[model samples]
Target chain A: MLDVIKSVLAAFFGVQSEANRQRDFQAASPWMFIVVGIALAAVFVLIVAGVAWLAAQ
Target chain B: MKRFALTGICFLLLAALMAGSTYAASINTSTGWNMPPGVTDVSREVYSLHMTIFWICVAISVVVFGAMFWSLFAYRKSKGAKSAHFHENTTVEVIWTAIPLVILIVMAVPATATLKKMYDTSNAEIDILVTGYQWRWRYEYLGEDVSFFSNMSTPRDQIQGLEEKGDNYLVEVDEPMVVPLGKKVRILLTANDVIHAWWVPDLAVKKDAIPGFINESWFLVNEPGIYRGQCAELCGRDHGFMPIEVKAVPQEEYDAWLASRRDAAVAEAAGADREWTMDELMERGAGVYNTYCAACHQPEGQGLPPVFPALAGVGMSVDPEQRAEHIAMVAYGKTGTAMPAFGDTLSPAEVASVITYERNAWGNDTGDMVQPSEIRDLLGK
Candidate 1:
């Protein structure tokens, strides 16, 4: 799970090494990455919205 | 020598950037260059956001073009350099995409904040319903019983180039929408005929006025001054003629102005009750005709052919027997035609006068006169 979160965060930034890409693709199922990516995306949106709300205040 | 050349290039770029910043700062007040840091807090924030994003783009372009040019010159054919064939280089692609994504996230932060502030139109002190017509704007103060139409005050001769144009040639209006300074003024926008946009740059309020749909926008003026804008949408032939003017005054002055406007509206309503003489109706009718009717029917009563029929000594005007038909045509316009019903747009007095004027003027002398009371009776008002 920790490795999956790390890989998803790297993917969110669009920055992943060749070794990491090979490892991620070699994994049996993409379900882990997919689930993690979606969860991280929602968190990213909440963080941005929170910052905006604070700045407006 | 190569290192020296690179250093010289960097120095030149730095100098150019410095000169540009100085020039932009100096020309901030000039209308030709850059967006104005407008009179309200939101407007100023918008301006700052614009500049921040603009500078980010400038920085990115500098780095990108610099690298591109340096690589181009350094690896030219003259230097015995050979091109490498590569596709889908993951590292380079990732770096490029990652940098842009990060930059976009940074840019979106402030923009979202400003957008939220702009959309928060709650607790506004004044609410005005702004309705757009074919070539005019009608401002109705909510719960204030003060409503009036603002028409362009620029003369026709200037437009035709027969007379010299004034400084505010196309931007002047007969009556401006007045607001109190330091108070939030929310405007509910809609259109009676077609889509039109109300835009005032100083207050940074621009929103569309669509038929059967109401859009909400708000502005709070920081300073007391007159700001002018025009209909930002192209609705019809006379789109360029409709202008918007907003005057921001102190609270007490605004109260006084609103009171005076209420009195004027009362007086105008009273005009409908009295018996108006022919001369009185004719004079008022001519003004109304020029403002509302002259766009389709020409100033001399000879309208454009086919699309707009001539009103002078022809059609319904000359036919004394078709008097009621003429009145009905003016009051409730002909369907499936460009002639819009002035029943809702014009007052009873105005409709009566224009009809009376069309019957009497342009040698269509039927010696006919329509009264406001008769029109009121016909409309059951």
Candidate 2:
């Protein structure tokens, strides 16, 4: 049972670790994720605000 | 474990905050969201159907998502969840499918009824032919001695965002469609060129006005109020400038309005027989031109490039014999071109006034005052 759990964890993290090892991964940069995340967050905020406003009306 | 727990708590807090804020905001404006006086049976039906569907969706989402989230938290891996291997349950599959089928049947019955109601525009009490031009609306009360053009009353400065927003803003119009309450109003909608949609959301009616084809819709107002809407179609450059205002008044008020409109039409026809001074023609002509012609021909009499031919120094403007042809073109329009037929859209006097303005403006110096009677004669031919 413990070995099965270890295998599953390894399967999940192994792919990520291999991808990170490649120098091509550096091309995307950390700021790209932050920028995209912020944009998505702003849109979510706006949608929530609009729904709230409509409900109040 | 601690990190995972913190992330879950944070997500829950964020969701709760967002939902709470939305709920609070909505409570403040509940009454303002009610449907306006529904003039037509179809509009009222549509409003009811909209509310019905909205609530149904809300119920469905709550039930489905509620179960989903409950399962997610209750059966999380951290809680030592065990996977159930009883995959093929025919009873469960049948029950789920049957339940969804029942829900769809309930929704479909009302939706179909509303659709059938929306399609019945026959045997209307009054018929009005509504034509959409580039940036204005023309209304003709069929079989009645009443027809007029309506244009944006808001000044150019306000449209360009130069002036502070006025009370009406883009909702202002020089003339509004006035209809009597408790009468079934049938609207025959079409466009002079391109496509436009006549929509009044409060009335719960929207019908596409396509060029070369007539579409019909009807509405009956139950109460008196000033209801405003905008051109819902993206027709062209000045689509946003076109707004629709309908005043539903008592039957007596509507009768008074109709009488005045008839009087104006009669007065305009009578004025055509007289010899008008150049000043009078120019004053009225300028106003007519700005409202009807300026959108495509431009305020300076310089037409839009490539599509609309320049009126300034054009052969049609200077030649005396070509004046009739010019008037005909403005009235009947050149087919397969951007120039829409103004005959159906403009009153005879409006056509005459615009022609007079075009002939004299941009130093054409034609000094001609085309009479509405002349236009009336041309229209007959």
Question: Candidate 2 residues A1-57, lDDT tens each?
Answer: 343333333333332233333433454555554555566567768987986576444
lDDT, model 1: 0.89
- List ranges where model 2 is wrong by over 4 Å: A1-57, B1-45, B82-88, B313-315, B318-325, B343-345, B362-381
Q: Which predicted model would earn the best DockQ?
A: 1
TM-score of each: 0.88, 0.73
The TM-score measured for candidate 2 stands at 0.73
Q: lDDT tens string, model 2, B1-381?
A: 955885687578658866865674465335455554355566767766766776678668767876777678768999899988863554565577668779887988788767766667878999999989888888889988688877889887776789988988988788899999989889999997779989887677788999899999888888788778888899998898889998899999998999999998778767656666667767888888888778888887888878877787776867888987898799988888778788866667777878888899878888888877788778872
| Candidate 1: fraction of native contacts reproduced | 0.45
Native-to-model Cα distance after best TM-score fit, residue B294 in candidate 1, in Å: 1.5
User: For model 2 chain B, where is the 10-residue window of minimal lDDT?
Assistant: B28-37
Per-residue error (Å), model 2, residue B85:
5.7
Q: Clash pairs of candidate 1?
A: none
Candidate 1 Cα outliers beyond 4 Å, as residue runs: A1-57
Q: DockQ for candidate 1, please give it.
A: 0.38
